[model samples]
Target: MKACIYPGSFDPITKGHMDIIGRARNLFPKVFVGVLNNPAKRNLFSVDKRIEMIRRAAAGMDGVEVVAFDGLLVELMKKLDCRIIIRGLRTGTDLELEQQLSVINGKLLPGAETVALLSKPETYFISSSAVRELIEFRADISDYVPKEVADMINGGNAK
Candidate 1:
């Protein structure tokens, strides 16, 4: 079976992420939305919470599974038998970073493909950090995140 992986910190999944995931689901037979549990970066939500948020956002999405993994993404992709990695490009920086990582991952995995999708214009400006900021200020984030995610992040206030 052809399978692909979309890996991200997903501190809290945003609408932009859901857009890429929906598109990737259309392209790949099986798409695993891998939540990266990177130790180097402090996360707003725990891995379990991120996974739960993704699952809620992706409810009823067939052939798309939400999972969490720690360690090198390349190693996890290899173990998952995923030959493709889906990435969302929202800006020039995103493209640059993704290209660099693709080259590095290529050298490491040889045949793993990194497919970067352009975010839909409407959601392109949304990012998890911005969502967190909006929540901090008590701004309406209904347009930027799914209701489940919005609810999860809305409890905190600005310092």
Candidate 2:
């Protein structure tokens, strides 16, 4: 079966993310939403919390699963037997970074490929970092995230 790995911190899953996950599901037989536990960046939500959010957001979605990894993403791809890496592109900068990473990953592993999925027009500007900033400023984020996530963020129940 064809498999793809969508790796990110996913501190909080946004609608934009959900959109990409939905799109990726159609292309790959299995889509693994891998949450990276980066020690360098201080996360608002713990690794478990991030995984929980991703799981809830992707619940009932066939062929989609959540996992937490703390090392090289390319390594995880081999471990999971994934042939593709799903990445969301929001801007030219993102494209540059993803392109470079894709080249590096391809060199490191010949079997793996990176697929860049452009964000939906409506959610092109939304991101986990942007959502976190809005939340910190007390801005209403009901439209940027899922209903459950909106409730979690607004209700102060986000982990």
Q: Give the Cα lDDT of each candidate.
A: 0.86, 0.88
In candidate 2, stretches whose alpha carbon ends up further than 4 angstroms from where it belongs are none
lDDT of 2 by residue, 1-159 (tens): 999999998878899999999999999889999999999998888888778777777787999999899988988888898879999999999999999999999999897789999987999999899888888899998888888777766777766
Give the least accurate 10-residue stretch of model 2, judged by summed lDDT. Answer: 150-159
Clashes of 1: 0
> Where does candidate 1 have its weakest 10-residue lDDT segment?
150-159
Question: Tens digit of lDDT per residue, candidate 1, span 1-96?
Answer: 889999999877898999899999999889999999888887877888889889988897899898789987888988888879999999999999
Each candidate's TM vs. the true structure?
0.93, 0.95
